[model samples]
Target: MFYFSVSMREVAFIKQNKEKWLNFEKTIYNNQFKNPDELSSLYIHLMNDLAYAQTYYPKSKTISYLNQLASAAFQRIYRTKREKTNRFISFWKTEVPLIVYQFRRYVLYSFLIFGLFVTIGAVSAAYDDSFVRLILGDGYVNTTLENIEKGDPVAIYKSGSNWGSFIGITLNNLYVGLLSFIYGVFGGFGTGYILMHNGIMVGAFQYFFHDQGVLWESVRGIWIHGAMEIFAIVIEGAAGLLLGASILFPKTYSRMASFKMGLKNGIKILISTFPFTFAAGFLEGFVTRYSNIMPNWLSVGIILITLSMISFYYLIYPHIVHRKLKTHVSTL
Candidate 1:
């Protein structure tokens, strides 16, 4: 009886304690220092205890007491979770790597799209001879041709001023990339046009320099920054398409909500691309521009370093962060 029965006196005491329990809950809710995580853990333990107590003390005042406590504890736990979820969202920058790694399908899709353009560029360059002069100006082609005849296909690279060229060219290239990214949303076909234009220019540019009899010079001069800059522009276009596609193909949420989410995520990705691209342009203008005077080995080394750094930062770091997050969730 002492172990499991509910006496008349016990019932009366529970009725009074319930009012006090509600007031105590309100007080805890209002506490400025209440930690949502601590409260959630505390309440979960309490809920488990109450479940065991309910089974042992069924049909007793103890059962009634445990039921009331479990119900109230659940409300508090939910409240705490809601607050934590909001805080988690507010501090989202810390989770960017995790987010990117989690949505790795998007990353793969962006890669496949860029690879298609690159293959197209390579195939066109390999096939066409006069296509080079038609796409690159004859004046530039002739100059390059003359430079190659002199055994220096990349001689033009040795002539540019460092700071002045960097500032001017970086701004111009960034503007072009931004234009390509932002204009894609207008009709969904606009970006493909820009992409084709860029692809044609690249193919022609390479073939013209190659026809001058120094394909390696063009590769060394161009790919130093083209590697990063071109990659960023393509990714920026993917972000734009992500935004546009959300609106056109929203599945669960209202179109407006999906678009808002897509726009926010896309804008973040686009903004992040800016610094890398500007750095690429800077390297091209100041570093690659002087490659003729500089040792060929040094330019090659810088290119390798730049590619390695980009891979580590955007690819490896994000994957590591995601792995850590998964481990943490499982432990919780």
Candidate 2:
């Protein structure tokens, strides 16, 4: 029988192909390839060499080297294919949810801050009837008063065309969300200010309805959309706080690196709010106008569903995913 040591064959093969393999690596690393097609051609040749090594010397270092080279080339050749895949799907399905889970403390803080400010507004309005006018402005209060007399305190929502209202409101809401997120650059003060401002407005607005003996009615109507709208704002506020926390406390990472990570995660969290914002705007523009006419059960149902969806996706689902990921890593 013929006797040929694997090492002897491997040395001969490497001696023959070393230059070509090195050139291929250099071309890839230097970005000298003209296009993906040329890169793919090199990758095919490398794979053939890798296959030969695997067959002849499965447990040899040559096999390992060839396998690694082939893998790298394969990744390079199909890099664009991965990029061209459905980014939107990956973002929503994994990225955003992971971020939410990772930074849940910020979300809780935002909620507490917002709730405190709301209490301040409500207590102030309760003590002084003029507080509503002070917070909401005279014209708005007067118009709302007139609407109350007309038995439609929320009539203002019905004035605009549905589609126009949808577009305008959605844009405005998105802008506010952007503001809440970008303001994180100011060490989160700007974000906190925005949350407090919105919270006060909400508390005062609800109290205004209460003064007119329509607090329950107002809840049924406004909360149908407000549930999503306000919840998203809270989430956005959390993103801002996350940015601030990164800058304030970088921990092990360099400040710049931490800031960059924070910004990236914050943006992911911010993007996740868009669907909720759009849904809220649609509800306010179309469904809110009919609040006076819609059955109480339907309004309540919408509010519950919207709130439940937000809570489940942002709060519950994130924890579940994080736990599963931790388990997976532990097993690995």
- Evaluate all candidate structures by whole-model CA lDDT and list the values in order: 0.61, 0.82
Native-to-model Cα distance after best TM-score fit, residue 211 in candidate 2, in Å? 1.4
What stretches of model 1 exceed 4 Å from their correct place?
Answer: 1-93, 158-160
> Which digits, one per residue and each the tens of the lDDT, describe model 1 over residues 1-332?
11334666656654555455454445443443266565555545545545654665455646544544444343344344433456445233334554345444555665566566656765676787666667666887788788788877766655568777677777877786677656656633555556666766776677666655677887777778877777677666666666666677554346776677667666766666777788897887777766666687887887888877666656687767545543433344
Best by TM-score: 2
Model 1: how far residue 184 lies from native, Å:
3.3
Q: Write down the TM-score for model 1.
A: 0.67
TM-score for each model: 0.67, 0.74
- Candidate 2's C-alpha runs over 4 A off are 1-85
Question: What is the overall TM-score of model 2 with all chains considered together?
Answer: 0.74
Q: What does candidate 1 score in Cα RMSD to the true structure?
A: 13.7
In candidate 1, how many Å is residue 170 off?
Answer: 1.2
For candidate 2, lDDT tens digit of each residue in 1-332? Answer: 01224577677888888888878867754677877767766776787798898788888766655654554453344333344448677577655776787688899999999999998899889998889989999998898888988998788888889999999999999999999999998889999999999999988888889878989878988898899999999999999999988899765346886799789889989999999999999999889989999888899999999999998989998877656543433332
